[model samples]
Target: MEQIIERIDQLWQQFSGQAAADISKLPQSGSDRMYFRVKGAEDAVVNSAIATYNPHIKENETFLSFTESLKAAGAPVANVFAVNEEHDIYLQEDFGDRSLLNELEEKGFTADVFALFQQSLSKLAHLQIKGGENIDYSKCLTAREFGKQAILSDLLYFKYYFLDTLKFPYDKQALLDDFDALSTYLTHTENKHFMFRDFQSRNIMVKDGQVHFIDYQGGMLGALQYDVASMLWQARANLPEEWKNSLLEYYIGEVNKILPNPVDPVMFTIQYNGYVLIRLLQVLGAYGFRGFFQRKAQFLTSIPQALKNLSAFTGNRKMGIAVPEFDKCLQFCTSAEVMSRFEPLRADESTPLIVNIHSFSYKKGIPSDPTENGGGFVFDCRGIFNPGRFEEYKTQTGRDKAVKDFLEQRTAMPDFLNSVFDLVDISVAEYIRRGFASLQVNFGCTGGQHRSVYAADALARHLRNKFKVRVEVKHIEQEAKNWINP
Candidate 1:
């Protein structure tokens, strides 16, 4: 560690002399690995730091390039100072002593934190790597594979501390079964994107009132929901339920602003639940790795919390189909029914989790009953279904088939008329039957110009008695307005 420190000092010397003075007060690393920050005495140049350790594997210029790209893309990545590729030493910018977690710990985040992260999300959303190749997500293993490692850890932890060390009965097969269910659920992704793979609070640095990322060598192209889940579910910074849902939408809204097309929030959430479950699995593995292998008993205490979160994910209606499998595993490992058997649990019902579904289409299509719309049932704990109506497309030449269908139903148009309706429908259903709490409905039109917007207004009008409707008459050719149904 001393030799590595000296090498890091030499690297800092490459910068201006003022940096040397500020480097002295740096914290003694909490871990065996050494990290120190060297700031410019005047704060004129830039605050910087070095992370040094014996390379368990190795580091290289390619690694440097990855970090550099992250920095350029507005990602909260440290700038590369100098790298001893063989030793895994990194000298980079020091964003200074605030991580997102730190702010939450000390002076709880103001609205500014949300704004700051929004900017960061925007940067990440628009990010496209130069030289055109996307990030190599393949290098990072998937959660399915990673979950197995967690199972092994849980098994070992149970056997050692919980069983042998604590003299408790260890159920091995139950754990294996739970892992199997978790692995399968994680494999089904509704959407995918470049992921920070491990975007936990510990890894996010808040220096100079801005958020940045550290320990990002494990980055990959994966699900967008993974980072959001990590941020919301992080042990150190567990967010309020309202805050979590709001921030989740904020991130999605930011992402949609940059994408060529909008994303389905319901679908993203379904995927998010799966990612959360995977995260729990990874946490279990990490805990096992730390507790049983490293002799750190503190991590063992965290296992139950991880299990609890895992249970929450499984019991989620969006995640219901996968829950039975995951439940079996939980039952197997803990030898106690870990998953909450009673759901729409009283706590969940009282929370009033509201999710709105928005759909739009260009052609004249009939809209589904908002009550039946996937997003409809979110209003009621009991399941509700809305089959979006659409004007039947005419197959016969010059035949008034579509017109005939519309006249028969007396419905003007359909909201969310597009190829992705399958996903949209599923989302609405899940929101009602599973994630029930409250509901809002949105209808869109191609250009929000005509059909979709009109259909949306009608549905809002139809559901006004039971729902507080926000009906938008979006027109591609004109400004949009709300047609509140009385």
Candidate 2:
């Protein structure tokens, strides 16, 4: 890999690269799979380089054909300039560094931002372009397998993290019963459009103040609401409930304008809520896996926020969907009786075990049943009581950065987190001794607000289901006080 990178640099310097144009400071960010940037003869080149090792799309003629098709369909994608199939390298146009996330945070959102988002949706609705004519949504794991795998992630999350990592053990029958109910709720839900899985703030780049989509490899024929839920319930760029509703309507309007058969807004909204729950589960597993196994901190922070947002949506009346099992899961999070079950996991040791059992002290009402109180849970077993252990992880700016990254990664945590949590559970059970476990699980954005509080509650509830001992969930910064009484 080092030699490849060096060789690429050498070739660029020899060919298209120029001394006058600095490529070193280009706004480059990516996953382990690929990375690239804009290269220029001077500093005025309109093209960029997209280097990758993804064999599926790298050497295949399908990628080039896909780009051509996208262009024909009037999609605002980067133009392919050059390709090195063997090495998975391609030079393309440089879209600006400004993301919808940056724009909304900096200048505050405007009609233009909304309009661009709408336009992107409009283009997506009529995505006549095909990367390959034989593409089947069912053949891929994303569509056919997504529904089952996604729901399973939530069960696994509740199993490992809440049960194993946090040492919350419960009766086997109850756990199975709980999961069965949840599974039934998830399976009965309807499906919708070919969704751009990560269609949210960060992926939707604003180049020249126009929205250009990226990170769309996971696209699938799925639910429209899932994408809508993702855009609105996204951790990093969370809009107010009112704004979220308006955006949903706006997206539906865009779809209606382009499609031959107009979609029923009410029906779309219902499906969207179900997708939101599925996405949340998938996100938790994704984040947990990334954080625990892959050493990606960004995934760690997203789990709480994603779960909280899902909890709120399940209970929200405007959603008009009854995700009963999801609501039950949320209710379990707030049950003091449930959280107390983690007491057995706590060890009597030199440093005291800090178990934080959570409740709805932040958001006033649960979205599942608007009149009912349904907040998520938080379980922090990290030994923060020790100053030395605490100091090791504390970094001022890094905390803020972590929070930001968490918000960004919110929609993709459940599946990742479940994988991580499962590994942690298996590993810990095999190796770590029964002793003090101190964890700090934060579940909020910009103070102890809606998403954070709800997630904290869910985490707590999940922990309770796993253990037969006592666990405490604390709202570190909330103005109000609400604790579940066993």
Candidate 3:
């Protein structure tokens, strides 16, 4: 990462003929690409530039080409400044840190947030209608267009990664047949355009009282409803039902003004709902793959909310098509028992307990409690089999699938956590009874990189699920050197 940053700064200087005064990293998204802001520039890389480092050369080219074409069409896309000869790093207009998601979260459901969304959605309608005009489909990362294959892939992604992992009983073949039927129905939508496949608030940058867009590298020729659905029905957003209806209506009205052939308001909306289901299912699949399979805490926390959203959508709205088998699968996935499998029993607002779980190296010693109440639990995790001992797992941390699998299957991690949970449960109950506000739990190991991380995550998960308390898990040594969540 240090090497990438240094190289990117050099590239920025070479392009602009100005040494980078400061270069700061941006938060990483789901993609492997890394972003940085190189300040002290005079050009329209927004007075600086967003330096992007991505290893996928082809993806970089597609993004550059799309940016060129989209900007030419008056789309609100970032202007590309320069691309390195290798096509691995480039600079583009910077929109700063504030995003539409940040604004929505900060402002709540006020009229201000509504207007911002309307502004973004209005831009989206124009981008969809104009951005794809004569654009080269061959540059797309995967499918040239969001055809039936891509649609089915999303469905199967949900089935294989999310549904199959649940160990729930359902007619597999029948469910698949239904998946085909649903995909076919969605693929037949007439209003295809430049689909920003990940058109969510996080990607919509808010700068200088306007909305700009990014992360459309996955864009392709597809339905307008897909992008709209992706944004409004985003599970984590938990947008109001009323807001969803109003915003959808607003977006259609905006699109009608720009579209050569105006969309039928009624039919367009029904298709949008279908795309909404597809978007929800696709998100669950992503959460499963990155959370349940990869052991990422952030994604795991979102599962409960996603399940609730799915169930509500199914219950309240008619999907305009019947797929009994798909509906059966949905019922199973969104059932109370199934949701309970992933959801933490949230403590009442009145409950004061907040568990802080830490993973630390013995060399650095056990993590000290920051609060005035200094005494807390610190358990030695050295007894567990160390994945760090083997060369195969040395580079992988507890967050990786291979290391987590090794720790769970080959080590005594389960039994150790089971014993730990039994001991902690008593104290947690006692603490809540006593109206205590804070509980700190620390796990110590030889290196703090592998065993301790896994144990700390386990304990946090256990406490959140069983005790219904807030849990904050930190990798002490890993975080010290920025080793966590990279």
Candidate 4:
């Protein structure tokens, strides 16, 4: 760590003729690269920049070369400010912490956010088309170009790491034949544009509400649709179907603008769908390797979402080319019985018992406990003043501020929750100490839309924050309402 700081200090002095003020390490991501924010002296001309230390000198060189090439092509990429004598440590412009994904989560999928997506896709087309010119292919990290070899590498990655690990029954030789056919078909794309190997929301930064991209070190010469597939189908983003179609059309339109002659829409659609399948399988392989094989909790949580994506993709659409064995394998992978294996762990057999809490209508009966133990506390919130009785609060649920304030101010809900918290805290502490697994808590009321929902949400939040135990919350009646309205 000290050596890295020393290197950054040296680079700072060499570049800006000033001493370093301080260096702070940034959070690590999936990649092996280490980043630090280097601050300059109070009055120094050089402001703060991100300094990266990568052990892979070849990848560092590729990144530096790509940065220069892409920047000259008018792409919104981070500029390399300086590099040490070893070429392993370099400083680049820091584009702050906000990402497009963060923005989408903070704000909903509105016009403003969609506009950003539009701008991003427009820039991406330029990055692939204009940025492909005069680039040295020798500097590519792995394959000089994305072709049959690269496609097979991804398919084989899925096979060995994910598919084989699942131990699902299949004709191995037949699947291999299908894989070869699929790869050969995808390689016949009309144009070989620059492929940003891992183009997704997290890699896109939003500075002053404008989009800028980072982390293109793995880029290579490839078809345009691969990157498009990567962005629109990013697992966590879970973009709405309407938004996905709109954005895809928007991207193709942008690509047509820059092309000397527009690409054939029919052929482009076929190839694009093929690439989507390729990207989905590649991501599933990644999640399986990181989650199932390595036992990382975050990656494990993402499995169901990815499975959901695969299910939706295969449900209605078919690739232009048929690989029957691959289709059957995909069906098996997405089957309900198969997906059940990847569902997140239930608390019953695990340490630090997670309390599953729910709000439900008494009329609909209480929700059944999913845990094997099957019994815990159930509080009736019908005794409290009903927020749903008031017309103003009828449409609102517990999560809304108006409903919360009303429950806390106009009623004795606080006293009710205070007593409940005191009771639950006892069991929670003892469970943690004894390493017991599951607990259930329920709140019920007449309508289950306001008071019960509020109480359940409150208890879930309190338990999570106070005791640091996992808490899963469900609002049965409210969820039904959302389904009806949504």
**Alpha-carbon RMSD, candidate 2:** 15.1
Top TM-score hit = 3
Give the 10-residue window scoring lowest on summed lDDT in candidate 2: 380-389
* Candidate 4 lDDT, 425-456, residue by residue in tens: 77877777777778899999998888998899
| lDDT (Cα, tens digit) per residue for candidate 3, span 1-486 | 568878987887788777788887766566778788888755544458899999999999999988888999999999888888889999998888999999988889889889989999999998888878857778999898998899899999998899999888888889888888888888887788888899999889999899999999899999999999999988867899999999999999999998778899988888888888999999999998877666554576788889988998888866678899999889999898898777544467898888888898999877778787677899999999898988987776787766786786568887787678767766877788788888899999998889889888888876776667888888988888787962
Q: How many backbone clashes does candidate 2 have?
A: 66
Better of 3 and 4 by TM-score: 3
**Candidate 4: Cα lDDT at 466:** 60
RMSD for all candidates, in order, please: 24.3, 15.1, 7.5, 14.4
**Candidate 2 residue runs with Cα over 4 Å from true position:** 6-22, 25-30, 43-68, 109-112, 128-192, 292-298, 317-326, 334-486
lDDT of 1 by residue, 137-207 (tens): 43443342233354344445434433343333445566456556654565555345555656666666776
> What local lDDT score does residue 103 receive in model 1, on the 0 to 100 scale?
67
- In Å, residue 53's CA in model 2 sits off its true spot by 5.3
Off by over 4 Å in 1: 17-19, 22-32, 39-48, 51-62, 84-87, 109-133, 136-185, 311-317, 323-325, 331-486
